[model samples]
Target: MPVRRADAPEPERRDLDVRGTSVRMLSGGAGPDLVFLHGAGGAGRWLEFQARLAERFHVRCPSHPGHGGSPAAEWIEHISDLAFHYLDLLDTLRLERVHLVGASFGGWIAAEVAVMASHRLASLTLIDPVGIKVDGWIYPFLFGMDIPEIVQTVFHNPMAALALAPPDQSVDTLAFQYRQGAAIARVSWNPYLYDPLLRRRLARITTPTLLCWGAHDRLAPVEPCAQAWVKEVPGARLRVFADSGHVPHVEEPAAVAAAIAEFCGGIR
Candidate 1:
């Protein structure tokens, strides 16, 4: 069901019907499953950093419903809907446990998954994530900004940011992206940045968790919003990328990949 993008270079892709929604996933290498979830407006292709980790772990990156080539689900309303869908994906794939890594909104989903199904996760990693609203800290609304403005705020290198913008997108594609962004904001906008109740639930997660933050992030600033995770999530470790912003994997792939490999490798 998952069709490979004609422009994509030889990446193995497949689709699984989870709760009646077709979920597109890209997979490579072999061994323990390591799933990567991208943030808003991102797709499975965003998991290029996981390619190196694939040599030791079968990396599974799924295009969240309504983003990339996946069809939007009418029943899905909240972020938890996406989280539960991922849990269903694991069940459909017969994956008993896996190492999960997510960015931004995907990170929020990963947190929800860990809280809901601890037995299914071997470990968890969140990068510049947004799921909890910290008092006194104001987080920016990324969806409200234009594409170029959003990129400028999230990436340190202007060239790298330029490379991420969809070059061949048609008017219809751009319109659809905006619509999807609006839908995501509608469900996730409450508390302005994150759900107020999410932080309270972090203490219950038993899996070894790592929180990676971009020191220069403007979208989800580090000092308070990002660092707070370490205090709330028991035994959670934090790694800050000095020269990076919101999307560290894109801004500094090697460092992001190395941190992930080191953390996941140490997990029992």
Candidate 2:
């Protein structure tokens, strides 16, 4: 488990038995149910961005199988597996008309869930997602990149990424990151991050979709990736953070949270 400082707003941590898997989850706040899905790197951490969103809505952040403290599910061979896991999670919680938010890879998962069952969600927010392939637009190949290169590519402000880094890159930290990488590789390595059929399935998402992207995102550029998503999902809108990169929520938490809150507010 990643350690949180004493000063941060703390959320209740518990394990839920869903789909024969014990899922580690963090839940807090007092309003509508809002589930946040983390990207590849950060998982099971109570970050400031989540705290901000929790102020107005009940926020539930779950560690996907094989990430953070959650044990790996050997059956999860594809991204769709993770998507089904989350749908089961929502079913287990008995959450209705919930707001779903996902960043980067998690965004892909959220999109998948919406495609399968839009009735469970009130709104969907995707941040710098990389699941759909756009013709004539190519992002960087992330499999072989070093940490420094990845950090540079993910954040517009280098200092912002550095500030989020753990104080010491100890063996435990390295192992934690390695586990996350391996989990990503298991599902994404062969396909190289995009699903061939996902683009065609976007029309199935009846839930209102919000696409949030960093104007400076090097991993998934705004031109075709973000714009392409808007065109695919019916009535989808785009919100771009001029000063951020791939992960706008991390770089601009307050603004990102505000945008999400506003979007969810309208749906209610």
Candidate 3:
């Protein structure tokens, strides 16, 4: 037996076909549209943070291709492809000037989207975003480690991660998780996660930006990397979540949700 999700909205999951790829998206609540792009581990299921956001804005969380229920778009071999695909996704969904929120890997995609097309965005919020490469900073062995090792490295509070996890772990669930990892490896392996040209292009993104980071992030060092985002991206503000890990939303759901709500409220 396996459980699905905890704190996720009771809404049924739906899929939309965009350019031959099934983009699995979950929509809930009302008000202005707010799109959530997940990180490398994949947006498993809507978390308490998403539910909280849905209270104030219409939240749309879509699983990246080859992750969750979203089928793989084999042609997508790079982060640039994902950026382009999201552009198409916006057109297909008929969404206009929506607020964008991305976490981890998704934050990189959000930055790419803003760089490629800022006209379609009203605001941008990144949580522990990873796109810029800093000299002398190296990420831990991602694909080389087991789940426990990665978990310990990813979250500051291991107890929170364990509590948030699905109580019933099934074979299918493990397989799905593995698939998401493989998909991440495919796109991120060559460049090793960060786009060589991204830092230079941050200046082109004109949308209001907010950078949120877990103080205990081990993957992307906080010093030069997160610091670099604030320095390079004009008008971008940084907020650090104390005692949180890479996924602050999971570790500190209420605080992260409140930060997002407040940020979105001031967007003009």
Clashes of each: 0, 0, 0
Worst 10 residues of 2 by lDDT: 1-10
RMSD of 3: 2.8
lDDT by residue (1-268, candidate 3, tens digit) is: 1122465557447888887888888888788889999886556466677788888889888889988735678889889899998888898899978899999889999999999998899899999988778777877777888778888888898876764454457887777777777888887876787899998999998999989899999888678678989998889989999978888877887788889889878874
For TM-score, the strongest prediction is 2
For each candidate in turn, the TM-score is 0.91, 0.94, 0.92
- lDDT (tens digit, per residue) of candidate 1 on 25-109: 8888777789998887567573356666566678888888877746778778877788899999998889899999999888998
Model 2, backbone clash pairs (residues 3+ apart or across chains), number: 0
lDDT of 3 at 70: 57
Which residue pairs collide, candidate 1?
A: none
lDDT (C-alpha) at residue 57 in model 2: 91
Off by over 4 Å in 2: 1-8, 163-167
Report residue 164 deviation for candidate 3 (angstroms): 6.2
lDDT minimum window of 10 residues, candidate 3:
1-10
Error of 3 at 139 (Å): 1.6
